[model samples]
Target chain A: MSTKSTQIRLAARPVGEPQDSDFEFVTTELPALGDGQVLLRTVYLSLDPYMRGRMSAAKSYAKPVEVGDVMVGATVCEVVESRSPKRGVGDLVLAYTGWQTYAVAEAHHTRRLDPGAAPISTALGVLGMPGFTAYAGLLEIGRPQPGETVVVAAASGPVGSAVGQIAKVKGARAVGIAGGAEKCRALLEEFGFDAAVDHRSATFRDDLEAATPDGVDVYFENVGGPVSAAVVRRLNKFARVPVCGLVANYNATEAPPGPDRLPGFLGAILTLSLTVRGFIQDEFVPTRHDDFLREMAGWLRDGSVRYREDIVEGLEQTPDAFRGLLVGRNFGKLLVRVGEDLTRE
Target chain B: MSTKSTQIRLAARPVGEPQDSDFEFVTTELPALGDGQVLLRTVYLSLDPYMRGRMSAAKSYAKPVEVGDVMVGATVCEVVESRSPKRGVGDLVLAYTGWQTYAVAEAHHTRRLDPGAAPISTALGVLGMPGFTAYAGLLEIGRPQPGETVVVAAASGPVGSAVGQIAKVKGARAVGIAGGAEKCRALLEEFGFDAAVDHRSATFRDDLEAATPDGVDVYFENVGGPVSAAVVRRLNKFARVPVCGLVANYNATEAPPGPDRLPGFLGAILTLSLTVRGFIQDEFVPTRHDDFLREMAGWLRDGSVRYREDIVEGLEQTPDAFRGLLVGRNFGKLLVRVGEDLTRE
Candidate 1:
């Protein structure tokens, strides 16, 4: 095994769509682990839409990734060596190892995942941050009551998929909006959503209206743009919108031209008594994270929840996979298979 | 006594600022009071900015007044004749008398107000709907903590003045914004706000920045326009905004030009974890109206909460007074003294 680790470092902040020139590949010798630190080999590196926000120097909920830093991501890793009693050499763990093949982290920073319990890659998808985001933002903010209609865009993606399924679990009707027929089909078939509308259809707005005949009660706002505008019009009185991400505009170089819709938006918020809240998953850690873990694990075990992954073959495909994410090119949770999984081996 | 009652009814929906041509005044004999009903002599007709929403045929939180219907408003009335044991002749009551000189109301529809306990005019001002709006929207939605900055616009108006005074009462720093120096002075001197910024000043943004040294935590949004855009830039993380009214845009015929601020606004909501809620004061009647009356009455009794009135005489002047309200012409709670207040006279 190579003692040197390879990493993709940010070369420049992209103006719009990230290009290969925006990232630099580097190979560096791994430093010896310190006391209470574990050496982790990256088996899967999670590439998420939020990373797009982090790449920009603009102010956001979290600090932006500085230039020349390893492109930040969550990773499922195999503990290759341990300097603490908390983790063993072959244990599977979840760590924020970024876009790297190997990383060293304090043992406290890693969470051990039982290999026999589920696939370790699930740690990068449904049972991880994306899942937690959907669970917290939907239940805590979107708050779909039983029989209420819940509408979500990017319904084939991890966060959106989970939101639709969880709305079903809570006895709410789930109506999903996705880009194509295939994704719309998956939303209905795989996620068990009550209705699926193709956002890319020429009659997108009409399709949304047809799907949500009673008007939407909870809108899990993952993909913002025209889809959001259409969804907002159909929101029932007292609708709750949990704004988790706006992947559609993450790569825009400038603001959209407008007859400023904000006033109209605020008007809807007032006249409809809508609750529009924006959040990241961490806020609910103290209150709901444990409940999420226990409930999510049970659901996954009982086949009540299902997840799909769109894995790229190598770390070099990170930029391309991420570009595809912004344009709805990926069918599921996008992740890079950075290295071979030793957990199963 | 004029046996005939005079009323101002909606003749047409105005394009921008309401015009006299939009209203038609008519004198008609009121129906005879029946069992459990009282003939109320309109002593004070309250003219609020929300009346503008009712004038429009557009969809809103409340149903709009149809053309030829009497314009809706709250009033302090005297029981001229009572057919129910619950109320007697010469007693003052709070009633929805609209823009009229007299109204016959069911006893159940009116609340008895003691002129001996407080000024009866207050039932239409600080102790009435506008006062409760600030109380409920600020406390329930804004949730300002002690030492945190709470900002409100239209500072000298009934709703804004109450928000500032109540925020100060709660140990929060109160910053008020008004359109002119006179109103700004009233905010600081009469209302006892910590700081008052003139939204019409050339240095308005700078004044707002200087006033809110600690970023704003609670923004009682009574006015929405350029002033709001400036205040929003300084909101803190986890800041709460209780959108009670948008008086600034109540007269807007077209949406303002923009670099589509909705995206930037949504981005801020996400990054700051903001809770943006729009509410009509009625939602809190079953929840908090009693507490408001008790606490506000105590505050008034002890001279802690000071109220101002811009009383315009005669129901015939409601259109002009209401027009003045939209432009900040009336400094305080705009009330039309439609009839003799025999409770004191």
Candidate 2:
């Protein structure tokens, strides 16, 4: 077993966009596993937009990962050794091992990955938490009927991509909004979205207006900024807004300047009888997890749902890769290849 | 039969708080009534906060009352004479008669009011649409569970008072927020609220915090301003907000200055899994109106629910009375006694 492990610890609570100095990489010795524990080496670390929330001490659905803690994350790992009766050495498993090369955890804390079904790395991306979030939030809350328009921003990310495709499967018109034309084009060509609007265009508002002529019925809101503002304008009566994440304003240092528009927004809510609900996907897990696994596994098997991953090399590159996530730099599900995958079939 | 009748017509759209010049009160000769039409005399006119929405040309759930037209309103009137066999002379009925002393309406357009069941004027207050608004919005959307704390503002008014009491009937703790000590006292002593907080007091924020220690499960939102800001801070996870009106901002000529807090508000919505829905009572009328009528009528008969009315004398005082309603001057459901109720049994 490897004695030394490389880990990234949070140095400070970021005020807005996180900086490199906010993290400290350290080499630490891994302690021996207990009777029920296993030694695991991380092969892939998932960098998600939600990590931005955990970096800040702001009130949220989950507690912010404390400063100086190995920045918390999900990882796909190869089990090095096991003391538990349930596990064996060389097993590939999924774990919440944070930004680290290796760690020791209880055997029950990790789920063994079946590489025959798909690539082991997929346990950290497309068939993982982000994908599940989109599926549950859209189906349970958005509840788009056939022929209704489903609008989603951050369209190229794991969650948004899954949301758009799921809406299509439900027979709803999927409208994807992304930062540039490339991602927008990918939304239509790769993800099978009915319409894709480039939010970076100077005429983005007009483009959105032209694209969704029937108005938005279910807005799977992940990016809340100018894109959300434009979407709000196009919302039809009785529109449903599932507030999953607000990546656009996650780095905000202070409240934006205003002739406060909340009253106007509330006026729209009243006049249109709109339903604006905010949710974290974990709330729906207990009720819908089984249904999700069965349906998503079926969808994947049939090629009804497709996904992409943007993999970065090495644990040392995670900080830079994560910084790109907030500013829309990465093209797909951003993951850092922490270690070599030696168990691939 | 009298040929002359006085009518109040919308002269021009008011920019903010309505002015006397914006309403033109003119005496006009009544047109001859055709078959199936009845000549009605307005007895009690309902002056509600929603009338303000009609005065504006902005798009809303309902069409805007056009300028130069008689200002739309709900009225309890006496059928003075009838050309239709369905409505008899001297019958009391609820009609959409607008702000006029007398008007001719189709006999089928009005529902006969039973003076014996309750006072005829109660048709415009507790036994009518405003009361039903409180019932449907609270039970259907707010859905306060037993032992949960339900909070409502404008607690001295018809809608808010009913919400608080109905919440109590459902085994929830009812916290009533009113503008002054007297209204607050009425909420506790007269309406049987579990707790009453005076929003006018300098210690209102702390008082509200103390009153709702377990956090608010349902907020029956009628008056939205500082009161809403205070109540929002006390919302529990999965808190349901049934937004019925925003009386506090009704007269605002400009958006209030702010370090815009909308992002923060949306953040709270995400973190708390809050459900904020805006609805006009009429929307639910088709589905839940019968249920509301059965439940509210039973509650009133058993003394489980009570109501208050603030009656202003004569049609001439309506403009000032309405201006008062905008600023929370009237203590309860504000109504105008247009004429004597001679047909009362």
Candidate 3:
């Protein structure tokens, strides 16, 4: 059986911050499920900063979505029909089905989720890519030791929140940096970060200094700009930085104004004996994915780790929701309810 | 009996290139040997780019050489008199005696060298700290896999020369970047590097491209400047950079002009999944020293690795020799023969 799919495609490469005119929406019938394939009906679509990179033709770890192609993303969906013995109708599964209402994917390509265990939508958030990114980047690259101070910016968001919480679990002091007083409060109170500094404050640098009494040891770098520049100065000797994302510069049309700080940073790196490693989460899937699933599950069950979601109501809201994700407008794990979640009903 | 010691003290912190006036020469009576101490007659004094950092009050891994203090460095010294069982009269040993004609040091602090195994001056260059810096940083951090392309700057110097040879020993393709055609010739003919690119040539970038047909997988970053910026662009996905030194920017009084390239570098790091690690060799002494000594000895004996020294005749030439070392004037490991080698007799 075939189903109609409403999709958003990249219309043009964004010059800077993506505008509405850069995306084109279309409706079409999806191809019938093949022999080892299942027909997926999208329920929740994730909106993330990485989407900005995919919208442009700039060089990145992943290939950009083409002009006429559906904007790619992680989606939690329900299997409506199946031609394979692996999946049954109405089974909830996690898939890379992009920003569309319906998709046909191979059974082996998607992982079935147990809705009875936790909220199915979490497959796109805390239990998914963002969570895994924090897990792999922190444990492998950052390697924060007990009593060491581990700092992360955008701390109210899914990846940063997970990073801080995981660092706490590893017995390190977790210091978080976020945009506003409210997000800072969430970081300290809800996310259980030992300290939280508001980056938007006029006294942000001083606030960061006050928060991290002991110098930073592991900086989980997900945001770049003045915030990262200030944090780098406060890093202790033998510090480690795991660069996962740079949301601040994703929309930059041109290089920022001079005096180039690269040499100074390199100098600091040499004098301090620092390690700065950049990574994409998918690279860790083979070795660390199983451990992440097991440990994170326990953290979630025991209430040691908590998460929040900012769920938008409709599929059409994806563009605006994504724009919000880039500028610190979304408070938590941002998700778009693309269609009805049958399992919730 | 007693002898007078001639020393060079830092008269002033240099603004750019260190001038002869920045150093003050003084002669003083050597103190009588105390218990567990040896009176050392300096033979070969090592002069390296790191000395520039020590002349300044800027924060670094090691303490700065305070004004009016004898400049600190590694030296090959003779045990003319001893009050300890660890050293006997006429024995040659490695010592941290700085730029001086004679010194009194604890016997326990010096490592006795076997003149029969190799030349005594080698204890300050190829068989000493600089050689170990190349070995530990490249093997530990760079981790060049077989058939991978490894690039190093200052390829004719002790550290870079050893780095290229060691990379070749590990079955990786070695590409050397040096200042002049003569050094580039030495890199290919004398050092056995697979390819050599002269950074001073007008077509350097194009030459580098021609050398590394497959991209660079490992970059041993010693000289940080325009050459480093160019090498950074040629790095492939998952490249590793072991930043042991930054000689090019060591003399700069102020930050180079704009637009700042730090963001772009960090962006490339993220997209390429690079590992940029900075280290001082002393940190690895506890763990990798034994292996380095054994393996490096084997490589040297088997003709898999070779090194050259540019020895200056007198102690007074240090100031000029050091100034030349910073600007790539020295062809190899720059050393000063501070006094007569009694072992030659």
TM-score of chain B of each: 0.97, 0.98, 0.99
Q: For candidate 1, write residues A1-345 as lDDT tens digits.
A: 336889999999998999889999999988888899999989999989999999999988889999999889999998999999999998889999899899989999999998888889988889999999999999999888999999989999999999999999999999998989999999988999999999888999888889999999999988888899999999888899998888888998888998899899888888888888889899999999899989999999887789999989998888888889889999999889988976658
TM-score of each: 0.98, 0.98, 0.98
Q: Candidate 2: how many backbone clashes?
A: 0
Task: Summarize candidate 3's per-residue lDDT along B5-42 as a digit string, tens digits.
Answer: 99999999999999888999999998898999999999
In the range A170-266, model 3's lDDT, one tens digit per residue, is 9999999999999999998999999999999999999999988899999999999999999998999999999999999999998888998999999
The docking quality of candidate 1, as DockQ, is 0.80
Candidate 2 lDDT, B265-336, residue by residue in tens = 888888899999999888899999888878888998999999999999899888889999988899988999
Q: Identify the leading candidate in terms of DockQ.
A: 3
DockQ of each: 0.80, 0.82, 0.88
The full ranking of all candidates by DockQ, starting with the best, is 3, 2, 1
Candidate 2 chain A vs. true chain A: TM-score?
A: 0.98
Query: How far off is residue B65 in model 2, in Å?
Result: 1.3
For candidate 2, write residues A54-96 as lDDT tens digits: 9988777788989889999999988888999877998999999
What lDDT is reached at residue B210 by model 3? 97
Model 2, residue pairs in steric clash: none
Q: What residue pairs clash in candidate 3, if any at all?
A: A260-B260
Q: Candidate 2 at A65: error in angstroms?
A: 1.7
